[model samples]
Target: MEWTLPQWGQLMTLFMIAIAMGMDAFSLGIGVGMRGILLRQAILVSITIGFFHTVMPLAGMVIGRVLGLFVEKIAVMVGGGLLIFLGVNMLYHARKQGEAGVLRDLASFWGIFLFSVSVSLDSLSAGLTLGLFEADTLLTMLLFGWMGMLMAGAGLLLGRRVGAWIGGYGEAVGGMILIGLGLRFLL
Candidate 1:
Protein backbone atom coordinates (compact mmCIF):
# COMPACT_ATOMS: atom_id res chain seq x y z
CA MET A 1 0.00 0.00 0.00
CA GLU A 2 1.11 3.55 -0.73
CA TRP A 3 0.69 4.96 2.80
CA THR A 4 -1.02 8.12 1.68
CA LEU A 5 -2.16 10.94 3.97
CA PRO A 6 -5.59 9.38 4.31
CA GLN A 7 -4.01 6.08 5.19
CA TRP A 8 -1.88 7.80 7.81
CA GLY A 9 -4.96 9.39 9.24
CA GLN A 10 -6.68 6.06 9.35
CA LEU A 11 -3.69 4.52 11.08
CA MET A 12 -3.65 7.27 13.69
CA THR A 13 -7.35 6.86 14.22
CA LEU A 14 -6.87 3.15 14.66
CA PHE A 15 -4.13 3.75 17.20
CA MET A 16 -6.38 6.06 19.16
CA ILE A 17 -9.16 3.54 18.98
CA ALA A 18 -6.84 0.85 20.28
CA ILE A 19 -5.85 2.98 23.24
CA ALA A 20 -9.45 3.78 23.95
CA MET A 21 -10.33 0.11 23.98
CA GLY A 22 -7.32 -0.72 26.13
CA MET A 23 -8.30 1.80 28.79
CA ASP A 24 -10.75 -0.68 30.22
CA ALA A 25 -8.08 -3.29 30.67
CA PHE A 26 -5.71 -0.72 32.05
CA SER A 27 -8.22 0.62 34.54
CA LEU A 28 -9.45 -2.76 35.64
CA GLY A 29 -5.90 -3.98 35.90
CA ILE A 30 -5.19 -1.09 38.20
CA GLY A 31 -8.13 -2.06 40.36
CA VAL A 32 -6.99 -5.65 40.53
CA GLY A 33 -3.34 -4.81 40.96
CA MET A 34 -4.19 -2.81 44.09
CA ARG A 35 -4.42 -6.08 45.96
CA GLY A 36 -0.69 -6.65 45.41
CA ILE A 37 -0.02 -9.27 42.75
CA LEU A 38 3.39 -10.78 42.18
CA LEU A 39 5.36 -10.06 39.03
CA ARG A 40 4.58 -13.51 37.62
CA GLN A 41 0.88 -13.06 38.17
CA ALA A 42 0.96 -9.63 36.60
CA ILE A 43 2.72 -10.99 33.55
CA LEU A 44 0.19 -13.79 33.25
CA VAL A 45 -2.71 -11.40 33.55
CA SER A 46 -1.24 -9.04 30.98
CA ILE A 47 -0.66 -11.85 28.54
CA THR A 48 -4.19 -13.12 28.96
CA ILE A 49 -5.57 -9.63 28.35
CA GLY A 50 -3.38 -9.20 25.29
CA PHE A 51 -4.66 -12.45 23.85
CA PHE A 52 -8.27 -11.49 24.46
CA HIS A 53 -7.73 -8.00 23.05
CA THR A 54 -6.66 -9.58 19.77
CA VAL A 55 -9.20 -12.37 19.65
CA MET A 56 -12.29 -10.40 20.61
CA PRO A 57 -11.73 -7.79 17.95
CA LEU A 58 -11.00 -10.41 15.34
CA ALA A 59 -14.28 -12.09 16.17
CA GLY A 60 -16.09 -8.75 16.06
CA MET A 61 -14.53 -7.87 12.73
CA VAL A 62 -15.66 -11.16 11.28
CA ILE A 63 -19.17 -10.64 12.58
CA GLY A 64 -19.18 -7.04 11.40
CA ARG A 65 -18.03 -8.09 7.96
CA VAL A 66 -20.94 -10.43 7.73
CA LEU A 67 -23.33 -7.90 9.24
CA GLY A 68 -22.05 -5.16 6.94
CA LEU A 69 -23.84 -6.74 4.03
CA PHE A 70 -27.08 -5.97 5.77
CA VAL A 71 -26.60 -2.97 8.08
CA GLU A 72 -23.64 -1.10 6.72
CA LYS A 73 -24.90 2.41 7.36
CA ILE A 74 -25.78 1.87 11.01
CA ALA A 75 -22.81 -0.21 12.02
CA VAL A 76 -20.83 2.69 13.39
CA MET A 77 -23.82 3.89 15.33
CA VAL A 78 -24.31 0.46 16.80
CA GLY A 79 -20.67 0.25 17.72
CA GLY A 80 -20.79 3.63 19.41
CA GLY A 81 -23.88 2.64 21.30
CA LEU A 82 -22.24 -0.53 22.47
CA LEU A 83 -19.27 1.40 23.79
CA ILE A 84 -21.52 3.84 25.58
CA PHE A 85 -23.50 1.04 27.13
CA LEU A 86 -20.40 -0.75 28.30
CA GLY A 87 -18.96 2.45 29.66
CA VAL A 88 -22.12 3.28 31.54
CA ASN A 89 -22.26 -0.21 32.91
CA MET A 90 -18.71 0.09 34.17
CA LEU A 91 -19.43 3.38 35.83
CA TYR A 92 -22.52 1.96 37.44
CA HIS A 93 -20.69 -1.00 38.82
CA ALA A 94 -17.82 1.09 40.06
CA ARG A 95 -20.17 3.43 41.86
CA LYS A 96 -22.28 0.66 43.23
CA GLN A 97 -19.46 -1.35 44.74
CA GLY A 98 -16.66 1.21 44.73
CA GLU A 99 -14.41 -1.56 43.52
CA ALA A 100 -14.16 -4.26 40.90
CA GLY A 101 -15.96 -7.19 42.48
CA VAL A 102 -14.46 -10.64 42.02
CA LEU A 103 -11.36 -9.15 40.40
CA ARG A 104 -9.25 -9.43 43.51
CA ASP A 105 -7.88 -12.82 42.56
CA LEU A 106 -5.45 -12.56 39.67
CA ALA A 107 -3.69 -15.81 40.46
CA SER A 108 -6.54 -17.98 39.27
CA PHE A 109 -6.99 -19.02 35.65
CA TRP A 110 -10.70 -18.17 35.56
CA GLY A 111 -10.09 -14.84 37.27
CA ILE A 112 -7.61 -13.85 34.61
CA PHE A 113 -9.91 -15.06 31.87
CA LEU A 114 -12.91 -13.17 33.19
CA PHE A 115 -10.95 -9.98 33.64
CA SER A 116 -9.48 -10.29 30.16
CA VAL A 117 -12.88 -10.82 28.61
CA SER A 118 -14.44 -7.96 30.55
CA VAL A 119 -11.74 -5.58 29.44
CA SER A 120 -11.70 -6.71 25.80
CA LEU A 121 -15.39 -6.25 25.14
CA ASP A 122 -14.85 -2.71 23.88
CA SER A 123 -12.34 -3.93 21.32
CA LEU A 124 -14.98 -6.17 19.86
CA SER A 125 -17.24 -3.18 19.31
CA ALA A 126 -14.42 -1.15 17.83
CA GLY A 127 -13.63 -4.03 15.50
CA LEU A 128 -17.21 -4.07 14.37
CA THR A 129 -17.02 -0.38 13.55
CA LEU A 130 -13.73 -0.79 11.69
CA GLY A 131 -15.04 -3.73 9.79
CA LEU A 132 -18.03 -1.69 8.76
CA PHE A 133 -15.62 0.87 7.38
CA GLU A 134 -13.51 -1.83 5.74
CA ALA A 135 -10.39 -0.88 7.66
CA ASP A 136 -7.02 -2.66 7.55
CA THR A 137 -7.77 -5.65 9.77
CA LEU A 138 -4.19 -6.81 10.34
CA LEU A 139 -3.00 -3.37 11.35
CA THR A 140 -5.98 -2.79 13.60
CA MET A 141 -5.61 -6.11 15.39
CA LEU A 142 -1.87 -5.62 15.85
CA LEU A 143 -2.33 -2.17 17.32
CA PHE A 144 -5.11 -3.33 19.59
CA GLY A 145 -3.04 -6.21 20.93
CA TRP A 146 0.08 -4.15 21.33
CA MET A 147 -1.66 -1.27 23.07
CA GLY A 148 -3.69 -3.60 25.24
CA MET A 149 -0.59 -5.41 26.47
CA LEU A 150 1.40 -2.28 27.12
CA MET A 151 -1.44 -0.47 28.81
CA ALA A 152 -2.38 -3.42 30.97
CA GLY A 153 1.21 -3.78 32.14
CA ALA A 154 1.53 -0.09 32.83
CA GLY A 155 -1.75 -0.01 34.72
CA LEU A 156 -0.77 -2.95 36.88
CA LEU A 157 2.59 -1.48 37.75
CA LEU A 158 1.13 1.95 38.34
CA GLY A 159 -1.59 0.47 40.45
CA ARG A 160 0.94 -1.24 42.62
CA ARG A 161 2.52 2.12 43.19
CA VAL A 162 -0.48 4.43 43.50
CA GLY A 163 -3.53 2.24 43.73
CA ALA A 164 -3.89 3.05 47.39
CA TRP A 165 -4.23 6.75 46.71
CA ILE A 166 -6.75 6.34 43.91
CA GLY A 167 -8.47 3.28 45.27
CA GLY A 168 -11.69 2.53 43.40
CA TYR A 169 -11.67 5.75 41.40
CA GLY A 170 -9.58 4.19 38.66
CA GLU A 171 -12.57 2.37 37.31
CA ALA A 172 -14.63 5.54 37.24
CA VAL A 173 -11.92 7.27 35.30
CA GLY A 174 -11.71 4.38 32.92
CA GLY A 175 -15.44 4.43 32.46
CA MET A 176 -15.28 8.10 31.61
CA ILE A 177 -12.61 7.45 29.04
CA LEU A 178 -14.82 4.95 27.29
CA ILE A 179 -17.77 7.26 27.37
CA GLY A 180 -15.67 10.06 25.91
CA LEU A 181 -14.44 7.83 23.14
CA GLY A 182 -17.96 6.69 22.40
CA LEU A 183 -19.15 10.27 22.19
CA ARG A 184 -16.28 11.07 19.88
CA PHE A 185 -17.34 8.28 17.58
CA LEU A 186 -20.93 9.40 17.67
CA LEU A 187 -20.15 12.97 16.74
Candidate 2:
Protein backbone atom coordinates (compact mmCIF):
# COMPACT_ATOMS: atom_id res chain seq x y z
CA MET A 1 0.00 0.00 0.00
CA GLU A 2 1.14 3.53 -0.75
CA TRP A 3 1.21 6.31 1.86
CA THR A 4 0.45 9.98 1.22
CA LEU A 5 2.21 13.04 2.59
CA PRO A 6 -0.74 14.09 4.68
CA GLN A 7 -1.00 10.66 6.24
CA TRP A 8 2.68 10.71 7.14
CA GLY A 9 2.33 14.19 8.58
CA GLN A 10 -0.65 13.21 10.67
CA LEU A 11 1.22 10.19 11.95
CA MET A 12 4.15 12.36 12.98
CA THR A 13 1.86 14.84 14.63
CA LEU A 14 0.14 12.11 16.60
CA PHE A 15 3.46 10.65 17.65
CA MET A 16 4.81 13.98 18.91
CA ILE A 17 1.54 14.78 20.66
CA ALA A 18 1.62 11.41 22.36
CA ILE A 19 5.12 12.06 23.64
CA ALA A 20 4.15 15.51 24.80
CA MET A 21 1.19 14.07 26.66
CA GLY A 22 3.50 11.66 28.44
CA MET A 23 5.73 14.49 29.65
CA ASP A 24 3.37 15.14 32.53
CA ALA A 25 3.93 11.66 33.86
CA PHE A 26 7.64 12.03 33.22
CA SER A 27 7.96 15.22 35.22
CA LEU A 28 5.92 13.99 38.14
CA GLY A 29 7.74 10.67 38.11
CA ILE A 30 10.98 12.60 38.41
CA GLY A 31 9.75 14.24 41.56
CA VAL A 32 8.69 10.91 43.00
CA GLY A 33 11.95 9.35 41.96
CA MET A 34 13.95 12.07 43.71
CA ARG A 35 12.17 11.17 46.90
CA GLY A 36 13.48 7.60 46.55
CA ILE A 37 11.13 4.79 45.57
CA LEU A 38 11.34 1.05 45.41
CA LEU A 39 11.86 -0.47 41.98
CA ARG A 40 8.60 -2.38 42.37
CA GLN A 41 6.69 0.78 43.20
CA ALA A 42 8.11 2.58 40.19
CA ILE A 43 7.07 -0.27 37.91
CA LEU A 44 3.62 -0.30 39.38
CA VAL A 45 3.24 3.43 39.00
CA SER A 46 4.46 3.38 35.39
CA ILE A 47 2.09 0.58 34.48
CA THR A 48 -0.81 2.32 36.15
CA ILE A 49 -0.01 5.59 34.36
CA GLY A 50 0.06 3.75 31.05
CA PHE A 51 -3.30 2.17 31.73
CA PHE A 52 -4.88 5.46 32.69
CA HIS A 53 -3.36 7.23 29.69
CA THR A 54 -4.94 4.66 27.38
CA VAL A 55 -8.32 4.53 29.05
CA MET A 56 -8.76 8.21 29.77
CA PRO A 57 -8.09 9.22 26.17
CA LEU A 58 -10.40 6.52 24.90
CA ALA A 59 -13.16 7.77 27.16
CA GLY A 60 -12.58 11.33 26.02
CA MET A 61 -12.67 10.26 22.41
CA VAL A 62 -16.02 8.62 22.97
CA ILE A 63 -17.39 11.76 24.52
CA GLY A 64 -15.83 13.89 21.76
CA ARG A 65 -17.46 11.76 19.09
CA VAL A 66 -20.83 12.34 20.69
CA LEU A 67 -20.18 16.06 20.83
CA GLY A 68 -18.98 16.08 17.22
CA LEU A 69 -22.18 14.40 16.16
CA PHE A 70 -24.19 17.21 17.66
CA VAL A 71 -21.93 20.06 16.59
CA GLU A 72 -19.99 18.94 13.62
CA LYS A 73 -19.46 22.40 12.19
CA ILE A 74 -17.91 23.87 15.30
CA ALA A 75 -16.12 20.78 16.52
CA VAL A 76 -12.70 21.87 15.37
CA MET A 77 -12.94 25.17 17.18
CA VAL A 78 -14.16 23.47 20.29
CA GLY A 79 -11.34 20.97 20.12
CA GLY A 80 -8.83 23.77 19.70
CA GLY A 81 -10.29 25.61 22.63
CA LEU A 82 -10.12 22.55 24.81
CA LEU A 83 -6.48 21.92 23.87
CA ILE A 84 -5.55 25.49 24.67
CA PHE A 85 -7.32 25.31 27.97
CA LEU A 86 -5.60 22.07 28.89
CA GLY A 87 -2.23 23.45 27.81
CA VAL A 88 -2.67 26.57 29.91
CA ASN A 89 -3.75 24.48 32.84
CA MET A 90 -0.65 22.33 32.56
CA LEU A 91 1.58 25.40 32.43
CA TYR A 92 -0.14 26.83 35.44
CA HIS A 93 0.39 23.65 37.40
CA ALA A 94 3.97 23.30 36.28
CA ARG A 95 4.80 26.56 38.01
CA LYS A 96 3.82 25.12 41.37
CA GLN A 97 6.47 22.44 41.63
CA GLY A 98 8.10 20.92 44.74
CA GLU A 99 4.88 19.30 45.82
CA ALA A 100 6.31 15.83 46.20
CA GLY A 101 5.04 15.86 49.75
CA VAL A 102 1.62 15.12 48.34
CA LEU A 103 2.85 11.85 46.83
CA ARG A 104 4.28 10.16 49.90
CA ASP A 105 2.04 7.10 49.69
CA LEU A 106 2.84 5.93 46.19
CA ALA A 107 3.44 2.42 47.45
CA SER A 108 -0.26 1.61 47.59
CA PHE A 109 -2.66 0.75 44.79
CA TRP A 110 -4.85 3.80 45.36
CA GLY A 111 -1.82 6.03 45.42
CA ILE A 112 -0.60 4.66 42.15
CA PHE A 113 -4.04 4.95 40.63
CA LEU A 114 -4.54 8.55 41.75
CA PHE A 115 -1.14 9.63 40.51
CA SER A 116 -1.70 7.92 37.19
CA VAL A 117 -5.08 9.52 36.75
CA SER A 118 -3.75 12.94 37.65
CA VAL A 119 -0.98 12.73 35.09
CA SER A 120 -3.18 11.29 32.37
CA LEU A 121 -5.94 13.86 32.66
CA ASP A 122 -4.51 15.98 29.82
CA SER A 123 -4.55 12.95 27.56
CA LEU A 124 -8.28 12.83 28.01
CA SER A 125 -8.63 16.36 26.72
CA ALA A 126 -6.21 15.78 23.86
CA GLY A 127 -8.13 12.66 22.91
CA LEU A 128 -11.31 14.68 22.78
CA THR A 129 -9.74 17.05 20.27
CA LEU A 130 -8.37 14.19 18.18
CA GLY A 131 -11.75 12.49 18.23
CA LEU A 132 -13.40 15.54 16.75
CA PHE A 133 -10.90 15.22 13.90
CA GLU A 134 -11.68 11.49 13.63
CA ALA A 135 -8.08 10.38 14.20
CA ASP A 136 -6.88 6.77 14.15
CA THR A 137 -8.00 5.42 17.50
CA LEU A 138 -5.73 2.37 17.71
CA LEU A 139 -2.55 4.29 16.93
CA THR A 140 -3.39 7.09 19.29
CA MET A 141 -4.12 4.78 22.20
CA LEU A 142 -1.01 2.70 21.63
CA LEU A 143 1.27 5.70 21.37
CA PHE A 144 -0.23 7.31 24.41
CA GLY A 145 0.03 4.17 26.53
CA TRP A 146 3.50 3.22 25.42
CA MET A 147 4.97 6.71 25.60
CA GLY A 148 3.32 7.43 28.94
CA MET A 149 4.84 4.32 30.45
CA LEU A 150 8.23 4.75 28.82
CA MET A 151 8.58 8.42 29.73
CA ALA A 152 7.35 7.86 33.22
CA GLY A 153 9.76 5.01 33.79
CA ALA A 154 12.61 7.08 32.47
CA GLY A 155 11.69 9.94 34.76
CA LEU A 156 11.44 7.77 37.84
CA LEU A 157 14.76 6.08 37.14
CA LEU A 158 16.44 9.39 36.37
CA GLY A 159 14.97 11.01 39.43
CA ARG A 160 16.48 8.34 41.63
CA ARG A 161 19.95 9.04 40.23
CA VAL A 162 19.83 12.80 39.57
CA GLY A 163 18.94 15.82 41.60
CA ALA A 164 15.61 17.64 41.48
CA TRP A 165 16.77 20.02 38.75
CA ILE A 166 14.50 18.77 35.93
CA GLY A 167 11.44 18.76 38.07
CA GLY A 168 8.71 20.64 36.17
CA TYR A 169 10.35 21.36 32.84
CA GLY A 170 8.95 18.24 31.22
CA GLU A 171 5.45 19.42 31.91
CA ALA A 172 6.33 22.91 30.66
CA VAL A 173 7.50 21.50 27.37
CA GLY A 174 4.38 19.41 27.09
CA GLY A 175 2.28 22.49 27.73
CA MET A 176 4.03 24.39 24.95
CA ILE A 177 3.48 21.53 22.55
CA LEU A 178 -0.21 21.46 23.29
CA ILE A 179 -0.50 25.19 22.88
CA GLY A 180 1.20 25.01 19.49
CA LEU A 181 -1.06 22.18 18.38
CA GLY A 182 -4.07 24.11 19.56
CA LEU A 183 -3.00 27.13 17.56
CA ARG A 184 -2.51 24.91 14.55
CA PHE A 185 -6.09 23.71 14.87
CA LEU A 186 -7.33 27.27 15.24
CA LEU A 187 -5.44 28.51 12.21
Question: What TM-score does candidate 2 reach?
Answer: 0.95
- lDDT tens readout by residue for model 1, 95-168: 76553364666667887888888778778877877777677889988999988988888788887887455544
Model 2 per-residue lDDT tens digits across residues 117-161: 888988998898888988888888998999999999999998999
- Poorest 10 consecutive residues by lDDT, candidate 2: 96-105
User: What's the CA RMSD for each of the models?
Assistant: 2.5, 1.3
TM-scores of the models, in the order given? 0.84, 0.95
Candidate 1 collision pairs: none
Residue pair clashes in candidate 2 = none
lDDT of each: 0.77, 0.87
